[model samples]
Target: MRIAVFIKKTTFHKGYGGIETQNKSLCEGLTKRGHEVFVFSPKLELDRNSIVENGVRYIFVSCAFKMDGFFGERNKDNWFTRSAQRFEEEHAKQPFDVVIGQSSAAVGVIKRKWELNIKVVSVAHGTIISEYKTFLNNMVGLREWIKIVSNTGYVLKSFFSRQREYVHGSEKVVAVSNFVKSALVDETFVDAQKVEVIHNGVDGGARPIQAHPNNQPLKLVYIGRLERSKGLQNLLKAISRLNNVTLSVIGDGPYLPQLARLVKSLHLSERLIFVGRVAPEKIPEILSQANVFVYPSLRYEGFPMAVVEAMFCGLPVIASNIGGISDALENGTTGYLVKSGIIADLRDTIREFVNKPDLIRKMGDAAYAKAQREFNLDTMLSKYEKILEDVVK
Candidate 1:
C-alpha cells in the first residue's frame, strides 16, 4: 500500500529528538515491509529539500524554524491551509492510499482528508493539551504577563481545535501507550474506542555490549532531551548525594545552561559529564558503558523511546514511575521506578542501586528479556502495519 506519513520535521541520527527518530524508523519499517512510503516533513536545512531513501521518499516543505523550529512560534506557516496546498500540488501527479500525520497538532492531514478524500490518521505522541496548559499556566512577570494575555486565547483555541481534529479527522488516533490514549480520551473527550495504544519500539539492530559495573567507576546515563520536564535537576541532586558515581548526560535542550549552572553550584562538575545531543544510533554503545540508565522525567510522557532502547541494550532503567513508564518496566523486577518529582525517592533509589551493585546485572538481564519479548522493533512494526490495514479497510 502507498502511504503518506506526515511529521513536523525530518532529521537523521544527528538531527533532533524522539519524533524525528520514530518517524524515520516507521518510514524504514514500512518500506522494509514492501509498502510505498512517502514522508512529508518541513525542510529545515537550506540544502536538499527532498530525498528518497531505500524505498521511502521524503518531501520537506518550507517552515519557519527549519528542523529545530518544531514548537517555535513560527510554525504557523505549516498549517492545514499551507500544507494542503503544497501536498496537493506535489502529489497532483500521483496519489497516496493512506495519510498518517504525527504530532497531532500538524492539522495538514485534516485538510488533506477533506481535499483528497483519503483516510487520514493522526498519532498523538504525548499530553500536548496538558503541556500547552502547563506552558500557559507557567507564564509569569509583567511584560511576559502581557504577552500571555494577548496570545492566551490563541493557544487555548488551537489546543481545543487540535483535540477536535484528532477525535474527528483521522480514522482513529494512534497513541504511544494506554497512558497517552487515556489522557487524550479524558482531556480531549475523544471516544475511547477511537484510540489504539501502540507502544514505541526500539531499534534492536545495535549489538549489545557487556560492561560489568566494576568498583572502579559506576556510570549513570540519561539519554533524551534535557528539558525541565525530564527531571535532570533531580538526577543531578541525586548524583550529588551519592559518591563515586559519574553521570554522563546525553541529549540537549533549552534546560542545559540552567542545568550546567546547577551542576557547578552543587560542585558536581567532575561527577557529571554533559555530552549534549548524542545521536540515537550511538545510544546503545553509551548505554553499554553505563551501569544504570536513568530517565527521571517528571512530566506526562507518552512512552519514552530512549528508556526502551536502554532496556534493549541490557541496562537497568532508573526512571520515574509515571505515565506509561511503569507499564514498560516492572518495578523491582526489570528496573527500579521511583516516585516522580520526589528528590528523596530518587536519591533513595540511587542509593539502593549503589549498595546492591550485583542486582544491576540481574535487572538488566530481565529488562533485556522484556525488550526481546515485547519491545522489539519488528514486533512493533508488524503491529503498526496491521493497525494501518485495519484502519484503511
Candidate 2:
C-alpha cells in the first residue's frame, strides 16, 4: 500500500515528543511491512526540502494561510494547506492510497476530499475541550497567557469550522488513549462509534534491569520536556523529605532555570542530577539506571510515551492520576498513581518505594510484562496497518 502521512512537525524538525515518536515509529513500521510511506511536515532538520530516512520519505512544506474567521472555517491555511499542495505535487508522480493526518495537519486534504478523491484518517492527540478545561493546571505568567490565547483561537476554529471535517470528512479517527476517546466523544461530541482507542506505544523490547544495590541510594528518573506545568519543582518538594532517594532529570526546556532554582532552594542539588538531552538510544540505559520513573505533570496529556518507555525498561512508575497515566499504570500492581498536584500524595507514594524497595522489583516485573503484552510498538503498528487496509478496501 502507498500512504501519505501529514503532521505539523516531525522528529526531524522538532525534538522527540509522544506524537512525534508515534508518527516516526508508524511510518517506519509501515515501510517495513512493504508499504510505501511519504511524510509531510512544515520543516525538517536538513537543508533540503525532502529526505528519505528509515525507508520513508519526508517532505518539508513552507506554506501558511489563515481561516476565513478566527473561530470558524474548516478549510486550508496553517500547515495543512502548504503540505497538501506539496502532496498534490508528489501524487502526480505516483498516487497515494490514503492519508493519515495528525490533529489539524491534514485539514486541507480533508476539505478537498471530493476533489482529491482520497480517504483521510485523523489521529487526534487530545480534544480542544480538554485543553480548555486544564489550561490553568499546567500554565502561568505572561508567556503562558500568550500561548493560551493562541490556543484559544485554534479551539474556537476546531469547534466552529474544522470539527465538521474531523467528524464527517475522515474515514476514521484514532485516539491515543481511552481517556482521549472519552474527551472526543463526551466533550467534543464526536461520534463515539467513529473514534477508535489505540493507546500510544514505545519502540523498545521489554528489558528488565538488574537488581538494585543495597548500599546505593534509590534512583528515580523523570523524562520529558522540563516545563513548569510538568511540576518538576513540585517533584523536588516531594522528594525533599527523603534523603535515600536521588533523582535523574532527563531532557531540557525553557523551565530549566526555574527547576534548578528549586533544586537549590530545597538543598536537593546533590541528590538530583539534571542529565539534559541524550540520544534516543541512550533512553534504555537511563531507564535501566533508575529504580523508578516519576511523571509529575499537572497539565493535560494524551498518553505519555515516557511512562510507556519506562515500563518497557521494567521500571515501575509513580505519576499524576490524569490523562492516560491512570489507564497505563495498573495502580499498586504495575505501578502507582497519585492525585495530580498533591505533593503529599506524591511524596507518600515515593516513600513507599524507598521504604519497601522490594515493591520496585515486583511491580517493575509486572510493568515490563504488561508493556510487552499490551502496548508495544509492534501491536500499535499492526493495528494501524489493519485499519489502513480496511479503510482502503
Candidate 3:
C-alpha cells in the first residue's frame, strides 16, 4: 500500500513527546512492513525541508508557525491549502491506497477528501479542547498568558470554520485512548461511532528485568515535554519536602526556564537533576538507573508512550490518574496513581516508594509484565494496519 501521512510536522525528536514518536513509529513501521509512505508536514526554521529516514519520505510543505504577510498571501499558502494541493498532485501521479492524518495535521487533506474521492483516517493524539483546559489550569507568566489567549482564539475560529470538518471530514478517527475518544465525541461533538481507541505503545524489544542497586538515594525520573501542564512545579515542590530523594528531569521545551527557576528556589538544584533531551531509544537505559517514573501531569493526555517505556524498563510508575493516564497502570499493583498537581498527594506517593523500596522491584516486575502483555509497538502497528485495510475496503 502507498500511504500518505499528513502530520503538522515531520521532523522527529522522540524523547521530546509522544505524538512525534508515534508518528515516526507508524510511518517507519509501515515502511518496514513493505508499504510505501510519504509524510506531508510543515517545516521549522532549523529543520531540513525534506528528508527520508527509515524508508519513509518526509515532504515539508509550509512554515510550522502560522505566518502571513500583506493581503493574507501567506494565509492562502497555509498548511491546509498546501497539503491539499500536494495530495492532489501526488495522487494524480500515482494513486494513493490510503490517506492518514496525524490529528489536525491532515486538516488540509480532510477538508478536500470527499471532493478528491479519497479515504482519510485521522489519528487523534489529543483534542485541542483538552489541551486548552490543561493550559488554563496551569496558567502562569506572560508567555503562558499569550498562549492561552492565542489558543482560545484559534479554537473559536477553527470551530466555526473548520473544526467540525476536521472530525466529520474523515471516514474514521483513531483516538489514542478512550479518554481522547471521549473528548472528540463529548467535547467536540463528533459521533462516538466514528472514533476508535488505539493506545500508544513502545517498541520494547526483549530486555532483562531491571536490577536496582542497594543503598542508593531514591532516583525518580520524569519524562515528557517540559511544560506547565506536566505539573513539574508541584512535583519539584513535593521533592523539596522529601529527604534523600533525587530526580532526573528528562526532555526539554519552553517551560525549561521557569522550571529551572523553581528548581533553584526550592533548593533542589543538586538532587533534582535535568538530564535534558534524550533520544527515546536511550530512555530505557536511563530508566534502569532510576527506581521510579513520575508523571505529574495536571490534565488530559493521550496515552504517553513514556509511561509504557518506563514500565518496560521495569520501573514502577507514579502518574496522574486523569485522562488516559488512568489506563496505563494498575493502581497499587503495577504502580500507583495520584490526583494530578496535588503536592501532598505526589509527596506521599513518592514517600510510599521511599519507605517501601522493596515494592519498587515487585511493582516494576508487574509493570514490565503488563507492558509486555499489552503495550508493545508491533501490536499497535498491526491494529493500525488492520484499520487502514478495513477503511480502504
Candidate 4:
C-alpha cells in the first residue's frame, strides 16, 4: 500500500517531541512492512526537498515560518494548504492509498480530500482546548500573559476550529486513548463509531532493562518536556519533602526557567539534577540508572511515550491517574497513580516507594512484562497497518 503521512514537524529533521518520535516510528514501521510510505512535513534540518532513508520517503514543505509559533501568526501563509498542493503535485502520477494526518495537518488534508480523492485518517494526539487550559494553568509573569493574549485569536479561529473540522471531516479518526476518544465524541461531537482507540507503542529493542541497584538516595527519573503542564513543579515540591530520593530530569522546554526557579525556591538544587535533552539512544541508559520513573503530568495527556519507554526499561512509573496514563499504569501493579497536582499524594506515593524498595523491583518486572506483551512496536505497527488497509478498502 502507498501511504501519505502529514505532520507539521518530525524528529527526522529536528525536535525531540513525542509526536515527532511517533511519526518517524510509524513511517519507518510501515515501510519495513513492505508498504511505500511518504511523510510530508514543513522544512526540516536536512537541506533537501526530498530524501529517502530506511525505505521511507520524506518530503519537506517549505513554509514562511516554523510551526512552533503562535497559531494565527504561523498560519498566515496557509502552510498546510501549500503543503497539500505540493503533495498532490509530487504524487500526481501514482496516487496514495490513504493519507494519515496528525493533529493540525489532518485538518488541512481533510479539507482537500475532494481533490486528493483518498481515505483520510485523522489521529488525535490531544485536544487543543485541553492543551490551552494546561498552558493557562501554568501562566506566570508578563511573557506568558502576552503569549496567551497573542495566541487567543488563533486558538479560537484556527487551532480549536481545525480540531473540530479534522474530527468531523476525516473518513476515520484515530484516538491515542479511550480518554481521547471520549473527548472527541463528547466534547468535539465526533461520531463515536468513527473514533478508534490506538495507543502509542515503543521500540522494545531500543533499550535494555537494567537490574535495580541497591543504592542509597534512590534515583528518580522524569523523561519528558520540562513544561508546567507536565507537573514537574508538583514533582519538585514532592521531592523537597523527601530526603532519600534524588531526581534526574531528561528533557528541555519553555518552562525550564520557571522550574529552575521553583527548584531554587524549594532549595532542592542538590536533590534534583537537570540533564537537559539527551539523544534518543541514551534514554535507556538514563532510565536504567533510576529505580523509579515519575511523570506527574497535570494535563490530560493523549498517551505519554516516556511512561511506556520507562516501563520498557524495567522501571516502575509514578504518574497522574488522568487520561491515557491510567490505561498504561495499573495502580499497585505497574506502579502508583496519584491524583493530578496534589503535592501530598505524589509525595506520599514517592515515600511509599522509598520505604518499600522491594515493591520497586516487583512492579518494574510487571511493567516490563506488560510493555513486552501489549506496547511493543511490532504489535502497534500491525494494528496501524490493519486500520490503514481497512480504511482504504
The TM-score-based order of candidates, best leading, equals 2, 3, 4, 1
| Clash number for each model | 1, 0, 0, 0
Q: In model 4, which runs have C-alpha deviations exceeding 4 angstroms?
A: 44-46, 65-76, 205-215
Tell me the deviation in Å of residue 119 in model 1.
Answer: 0.4
lDDT of 3 by residue, 86-199 (tens): 789888999998899887777777767778878989998777778777878877779778776667777666554455677888888899888889878876788899899888
Better of 1 and 2 by TM-score: 2
Using TM-score as the measure, the top candidate is 2
Cα-based lDDT for every prediction: 0.77, 0.83, 0.82, 0.83
Q: Per-residue lDDT for 56 in model 2?
A: 97
Q: What TM-score do all the candidates reach, one by one?
A: 0.89, 0.94, 0.93, 0.92
- lDDT value, residue 178 of candidate 2: 86
Worst 10 residues of 2 by lDDT: 65-74
lDDT of 4 by residue, 1-393 (tens): 998898888776554698888888888988888999998888845688888888888888887544443453357556677777777886697988998889868566677788778778888888877677777877778988989865676667655477788888888888888888887787687779999888899887334344445568778999988777889988998889898889999999988998999999999988889999998888888888888999999888999899999999989899998777888988999999999999999999998877888888889999999999898899889888888888888
Residue pairs in candidate 1 whose N, alpha carbon or C atoms collide under 3 angstroms: 44-67
TM-score of 2: 0.94
Q: After superposition, how far is residue 186 of candidate 3 from its true place, in Å?
A: 0.8
Q: Is candidate 3 or candidate 4 better by TM-score?
A: 3
